[model samples]
Target: MPWFQLVANGDATDPNDYNAVGGPSCSGPNHICAIQASPNTNNKPIITTPLRNEMITALNTNSSSTNVQLRTNP
Candidate 1:
């Protein structure tokens, strides 16, 4: 089945919080938003195409699947 996998570290899966579309991702509520981008300590908020494109390029994966990559300011 298609499922959301939370990669907490490199090639590692999160202990909890796995959903089809990464549901229950936010602790605030079970509510889903129509917004495309939401920045945070856990999730990577996407806004610009260049940024999105660069991320995809970095993924370096060859699959017709949706992937999400998160990073923090260092």
Candidate 2:
């Protein structure tokens, strides 16, 4: 197992120095797995208005209007 040594910023080379570190802190449910609904806040104004989908594709990934499929075939 690997050991972690927490030393002061300026006293990193000092062998006699020891620093306290923080542990994991959580105040919610111990373990919970659920689908998270994330919203897309970044989108082009012109492409977002016409599309009915809430989560729009990112505009900075060299993507164009033709890259998106607006409909599904029956």
Candidate 3:
């Protein structure tokens, strides 16, 4: 399987209020989006990409207010 990061708005208590790292907007009662992880030649997850890192950093910074979590789908 791949990995995904969940970004929840507000309290994160509602399952429909979250979205994937690189997915579409979490509108209505949509299911969890899947943002595939970037793996290296060794099949290991890598987050060195500038865009990914930027997104993660933004999420972390916003975590103080919202709920941002890093989850892996193994």
Candidate 4:
């Protein structure tokens, strides 16, 4: 998720009225509120290398085994 705040020249009615790509824009009669974003929750993994083929094979296998398996790089 993210967080935002209303800035000067920003209208409280329409927050998305102004384009907020290259920072805040407060140069009009219709006050534009500045929008800011907060850091996102870190759950995604940063993989620099390709995943092992064996792991992919096991995951693709449809077996009746009850034991769960975990794969990790050594």
State the lDDT of candidate 3 residue by residue for 11-62, as single tens digits.
2222233333443333333323223445446543354465355545545553
Model 3 CA deviation exceeding 4 Å by range: 4-36, 64-68, 71-74
Of models 3 and 4, which has the larger TM-score? Answer: 3
lDDT of 3: 0.38
lDDT at 22, model 4: 43
Per-residue accuracy of model 2 over 21-68 as CA lDDT, tens digit each = 222121222111111121223211222333313214422232323322
Poorly placed runs, candidate 2 (over 4 Å): 19-74
Q: Please report the TM-score between candidate 2 and the true structure.
A: 0.16
lDDT of 4 by residue, 1-74 (tens): 22232444434333333232443323333222233333223422121123223223334562211211222222
| Cα-based lDDT at residue 36, candidate 1 | 28
Which lDDT values do the candidates have, in the order given? Answer: 0.33, 0.23, 0.38, 0.29
Q: Give the top-scoring candidate (TM-score).
A: 3
Which 10-residue window of candidate 1 scores lowest in summed lDDT?
A: 26-35
* Model 3 pairs in collision: none
Span of 10 residues, lowest total lDDT, candidate 3: 63-72
Best by lDDT: 3
